[model samples]
Target: MNAQEILDECAALYTLPGPPKDFGERTVSDRFEPAAVPTLITNATIWTGNNNGTEVIHGGEIFLEGGLIKYVGDRVPSHFTTNNRVRSINAQLAWVTPAIVDMHSHLGVDSAPNLAGSADTNSMKALIQPWLRSLDGIDTHDESYPLSISGGIATALILPGSADAIGGQAFIIKLRDTKDRTPLSRVLEPPYSLLNGTRVDPTIPPRWRHMKHATGENPSTWYQGTRYNEARKLKLEQDAYCAKAQAHQWTGLPAQIPKNLKWEALVDVLRGRVKVNCHIYETTDFTSMVGLTNEFEFSIAAFHHAHEAYLVPETIKKVWGGVTPGVAVFATNARYKREAYRGTEFAPKILHEHGIPIAVKSDHSILDSRFLLISSKFAALRKALKGGLQGEIGQWYKAVAEGKIPLVVDVAKADHIATLLELKAEVDEYTGKSLRLTLTHATEAHLLAKQIAAAGPDVGVVLRPARQYPTVWDQKRVLPGPPLSAQSSVGVLTDANVTVAIGIEEGWQARNTRFDLAWAALEANGTLSRTEALAMGSSNLETLLGLEPQTDLVAYRGGDVFDLSSRVAAIISPARGFVDLI
Candidate 1:
């Protein structure tokens, strides 16, 4: 209402947004815990997540002090030895690297155990709601926090669910629990003016803010209309409001800056103050969004669940400001819905070849953030195979009969075993002898491992989730591993000469992948080596999904990361500027 207030509001409107001027020069992290003591870890085999994920150090040392990585190399600084407060840790040749960063997740917003009021992922009250924030719904007591952290997840970008065209704002959070025990405490780089009542200082650059947007089925299906028309109308309204405020038009007596709670965030997008992450699939959706961005004169940060992005890299490059939005996708998760029907495992490789930045993500709860790294491994593997080995119909039939090409059949029920047998018989009758066959999610395949193994040499079983649970009617006869039974399905199948591989069924199960492989190998009783177990969880998964290599890292102690005897000792996080001891 006053001259000073009006001037301050006008100055805030035009000030460009970015990190503060002194952000890069800071020695201590904003999240530095005062109680955290300095630590020195030595003698470790570190997978530095560098050189395209191929760089490895046999013996390395890392120093952690003042909530930052003071040093990392083959030797520690001489000054560290003189400090009495510094703690020393012997890694015993264990693996170490930067902590994992989950590119897309809904960890705290959609808490685990599926309780009645746990989920706050979406809102169908309106089609467009850019002002809504995921922070308001974050459950600090989320059960997945400790579990995901134990799996080496240090940070995750908590995104709002794609239930509407413009769902809401997203916030990045660190997994560690702070002494404050509040959601705000866990937030990373929150905008300086968000909670402050005082006017924003014009001298400092504002921090970047994130918003969630969607295209295609999700928005249309929920709102029963196209998002373009509605969004355009909103944009026009925002332009009018901004134009009036900039012109100092006084429709009311006070002459204050015009403000609309609902449209403020969307208006910021046009001003290039918000980084938009759009959930899109299919070529049509991608093109539509690209056009939207260009017309609105804003840039999208990335496209999440962009199943068909690989098919339209050129269209993505056409986004406003000449920056191609990164494509975040799943490794092998696809086709459960109509929109994802065309998704392929080779998408990452295709996008990478086209010069698009690619990242593997877990739609958490949808994919489990703990095993986020596994998705990358899967993507890497799929990239190597380049859409897998295929043959002509006639050649395939001959290879199958000759036990060369394996036919993978998904059988969850014990009765499905009969169907598999019938298919095998049909193949044998059509060709000569049916030999090559593999069963995935074969919950009860262990009961007939002898018969399946007798069918062929390449015959094998893949136990998804690595553990069995009676989650569905068909999986009721699950062979509960360990305490419940001496030998697991992996043990039973391997004993009959049927090869076995461990896998995950859900997002939460992803974090437990290492344990699953370790358990499978343990039950095999000397049949599987430590390296073989590690491959099942890492290399084999990468081969399956076609994910790109990551630069983040994790640290293990006593043994290999995948070994049952080993444990996560610390996280050397270059991104967070601290080595978090566990």
Candidate 2:
């Protein structure tokens, strides 16, 4: 659509009823199809994406129809058999799990991520440019979406680039390779912020500088040599223009408006409603942004690249916000002093300990999005081994509490939940298994992660899928209670028992290619049990995402999976047949 037409459409939308006054408006119920072909997978270990839990079955068959899981157990009821055409598969080799959800992304919207030639990525014209929208520039034809689809990425929350202090809003999009397809209606609300620019304010109160520069004949000569005067001139013009613009907006009067798109965006931010996901670093910037947020009453959803998040954990805890940092990305002195750069790999762990809500994102282009699972696992391991940094995920949750930071509640060993945390352990524990064993373990891990991540902290099963792709049937929470940490650990054995004839750990390598220390967990090299390890990846990661309870369906290729890659690759759906994972 043309720019004029887009604006006209937006204007017409604004004239309609605004957001609902009730909190119920936030999440609408999902619409399910009634009649669907019945398909059955028999005799397989199942990970009910219900908790930090998995149930191993020798011969289990599940009935699926109308896009909902009718039954997931050892026996299929007879009623489902009478009316529908049943296509049964020997699932002894397959591990089925929910499709992956990428909460933070720039796919399709920013298209190509690099800044060198992309004007669509950033708006540096002003400090607080909120008007810039990534959706306005989404190249739906971009190949990134197709690449993500290969990794079983079912949905992505496409956000604006974080080139500025205030990036534009975010939109959730279904991963589709169709020609001009309509996306699902239940997208997360778009949040935005303005990128602060380097413009100085000319209206500074001059005190000591005037005294020093006062000469008998010349005035304020002390500041003459620097480019301060030029900066001040630009600042004055910007301020005057901003005043005129604000006045005009209030009165609908003619005024001098800035031709700059960046400035125009900031007006939306100041008006509130748009949530800001800032890309900030320094402590000073964080403080300033908080001040701005208070002045405008807009919520700060998160601090995108908060390398300095550790510096002001207390302040962040005050506001219900989050941080999505590149966990392993440590800065080099070549770009800036390494001392100024705070890394993110362990930040989530630290924040969790200090009470913060944490979410992990690939932040990479489409092709490599699946790698996010590995990246998050790395963070979990580093934090867990470091002793003092325990409960890092919990700290993040503390930071996101709406009221005062709650005191740390004593959680049992069974309470330790994070899907990433559990996966790291499960993948490690079953290191050198047969292709079938590996497949069963990986399948259990993926499903457990989904369940733990989908449920919130109340159940102690951490499984927060991306906010965009969370199950929304009737908008009601339908997930069952999660298994305790101990139960979750024992659950892996259930899969291993029937999947393995002798149930011996002798042949398992304890380490494999997918994850780095996963072998130790498999070999019992580490004190943590295989179940405990899986809990870290499955339940812990879920808890970190605030999705403790999950209720969703995942379909995978029928077979014994050696690693996560194979399982991720075996997706077959009508829109995308045989999802490609390279």
Candidate 3:
């Protein structure tokens, strides 16, 4: 078929009609009935939308009907007026938090261990490149998503970098490593603002002009006046090129300009849809750009690699909306030609503390699974390690990790967990539990149980029955009464039992209370607590993103997301429509 005919056929197949005429509020269609719903979920510890763990109901049941959290507190409703289509999961010590929502990332395009080849990632030629959307180059097979999920990251905001004086748009994505039928549907779009662009901020000033001198009786030194004109001409040409680029006015890009892809991207910036992410650090440059940005009517969204943010904190805060500094790029004397190295990470943390609604991101080409979180944590810790106690940012994290004054801080782990938690809490709070829970049985869970049973009959016993007693059962003897009694002579094992605990006590205690001694302990040992490490990978990360976290958690005793060490299997009943790991 001709190209025209093909286009026409495709258009016909894709169009859809608008909403029905009677779609007004007064008239209800057969489309949705809020009253008609079903009951689901049994015996789970729900991290209530609030940040309080005590608010978390342990061993309680939740019922979802018509996609809403119908009955939430304490127990499931005994009576449903309608034929209750019920689904239950034995949430045996597994968490039931919201899904994770990572606020900062570049998952789809730049995968892990980024190499030099992804330079096409940015269009630096143009001072502005707004039209360059990231979704166009997103790779479904980007290894970063899978690696992130291994750390329990569910959703992410994949954004462009501040390469050009202006950057491109941003995209929100889910970290689901599967054969997704629709790639575009997975991305969420929202307007991003780039309040500032990149500027070179130096710690030490360079020796320029070296005392300009003009002597009437100049001596004939070396080349005296020989070929001086030749060098001056070259320098003037170089200066002119820079001057022309700097004088680039939007008065309809020069007609002679080729159809440059970078310029094309800039058109979008001109239209004001994409935010200009400038990499600025100096006060003078910042002042200069503010006027330019105002004239263009485009705002600066973020500032990247801002080393001297503290110098112009108020000015930067007033101009650019956000700042993300490097974690370890400190104590350098390179470009300080004009300004002094005020401090590292001071810009972001101070701004964040002063209510900038900060979101820390790793300015990396390829996504490093742990870099985002680790980088953020390092920023806070480095400040703490430098400021020594007066630093609120470091103290906040230190307190979160039980304030163990460890010699070495696993900033990476702390940062990861922190972001995860923040993201989770945001989602849960915004969209109350209306999740479509699909319980898939993991055959591995059953296999692992078999192996545990095969260990020995004596290995299956529990001396004291705790709240999780039923979950802790000896599979050596399936039947509870006589068979279990007969195996009693073999003796009971505590730690070896496969049963898990899903209580929120630990998570709660970690958040609500202050544990300076604990942090001191970590400091003394040069290590973070296990809970703190886990938080780095989970809670802390979610919190940072300002999105809700999917805590509909499913865990395996023998194996974590990284390595399935145990041979456990989960048997799912089709009739029940859900599976529980026993």
Candidate 4:
């Protein structure tokens, strides 16, 4: 190899990852749309996501021009206002906040409608393929982009699925569609080295690269191999390759730096240039991964779906480089698998009290990224409730006289009451039996909460849709939340000591995450604060995913973001360099 080429390769290996030198001074964003128009939004209540996400500005204004946030305060400067080309929007005291960021998502790769060929989230070719990129699998036609954007998700860290130990490299992307309509156009701060393969321009600082790693049940069940040992062997092989190249062992007339695409990404991870996001659950898995990081002298950015993270804060704090890996988890999604059997709703609060950063995630297709905010709301709800709920599944059925369907509301209410009583009787009968029970879609469960609680603490109830609606004959007596009823079913069940958790019924309901959270807080009767609600959808997710600050903003018209009266008005995205009116 030429002397200059070898020197460049060695130098790039040691280079660290960060933003460009002109990051803050740039007038236009890298993702800016050429057709974007300058926009000014005035008279809004802005949640700037500053001051640890507590900063709010009343009667504020924001100036967006050339895809950058030029001014954010009480007034726009006269110079910007006088520009004839700028468009103005009166938010009319609406709430404006940073657009939501889903840290752990598989939106495009997983794709919606669930077809066989569309599933590209995992590659089963090998258990330890780090060179595979999620970007390559992204389907531009994925139906979730606009849906996620409608839910205020501007940016997402598209991660590979957990089917492999070292699944592949992950990439961050803006959710907005670009004119080019290609996956590459949507990438945010793509690694410069990606353009020229192994050759990078030495002048520009390296951008942060992300990778997905999984341990515990997923890899064990999928590949039937000892994941930790295999991962360790790969790291050793990478170390040898990098060491040989750095030491200039190859001397020839025409030669290239030693490179193995399979292990190259892993080598960068050892050099501390890649942010490793892991999929782990049990405490044992966490300990193994922590030991791996310390032994290899690398760092994990965050642990995704870490149901047991709250149980071992000290162990997480002991990670390499003294940086505790952020814990990203679901708010109440648990117990469907053995690995998450001990998962609790109070995990976020417990971890927070231990000085550990926490974030709530959707896991995309698993929980629907559009409703990612609901996870945060439930997290906050658990914190406020102080670990008072429990139970898994419970069922009740009643026999009615054939063809004796009642049309009257009073008759239906009476029948509903009778069915609930019968269900409670069955619950009592199995109180101490060797059976686990969970009540799903318990629309009228609140009516017999005392009876259900009396049965046992092991019986849990799951409330779907957050709010109850009388969409069918069985749900005729569903408790209407808010003004009609002082408290929602969630409140009644909590008061009666029934373990309750909120969930969505279908994929379409995911877009209503903000409304679900607002309704949950409203039904709580002031126990859940607006700031806490906002964190469930914004800062909390960012912390959990170990992501950089988001620059996209969403404007809600008429009232605060949590208010049902408010509606999304426009989206100001610095990442996409444009203002979009919804």
Off by over 4 Å in 4: 196-200, 221-254, 372-582
Cα lDDT tens digits, model 4, 1-582, are 466666676676677988778788898988889888899999999999999999999999999988789999989888986778888899987779888878899989999877878899999998888889999999998998888887778999999999999899999999998999999889998887666664447756688899999988888742344243444466565456556666766643235545666677877787788899999999998788888777677899999999889889999998898787788988778888999988887899999999988887778878777664433443333222222234421111110111111111111232344443444344335332212234556677777778767756544555665687777545656878678888788777767866665556789987777877777767868755676556545554343233466778899899977777888899999878999998
TM-score of structure candidate 4: 0.63
Which candidate achieves the best TM-score against the true structure? Answer: 4
Tens digits of per-residue lDDT for model 3, 331-407: 22224433334434445566656554444443333335444444445454444433335566656434433322212
Better of 2 and 4 by TM-score: 4
Which wins on TM-score, candidate 1 or candidate 4?
A: 4
Error of 4 at 172 (Å): 0.6
Candidate 3, run of 10 with poorest lDDT: 206-215
Once superposed on the true structure, which residue ranges of model 2 sit more than 4 Å away at CA? 1-49, 52-90, 112-119, 124-128, 182-272, 320-340, 372-582
TM-score attained by model 3: 0.38
True-structure RMSD, every candidate: 20.9, 22.5, 24.9, 21.6
Better of 1 and 3 by lDDT: 1
Model 1 Cα lDDT, one tens digit per residue, 268-351: 787778889989998987877787777668899999999888888899999998888899999878888998988887899999
Worst 10 residues of 1 by lDDT: 379-388
By TM-score, highest first, what's the ranking? 4, 1, 2, 3
Q: Which stretches of candidate 3 lie over 4 Å from their true place?
A: 1-87, 93-100, 113-120, 123-128, 177-182, 189-286, 304-311, 320-349, 363-367, 370-582
Query: Which window of 10 residues has the lowest lDDT sum in candidate 4?
Result: 394-403
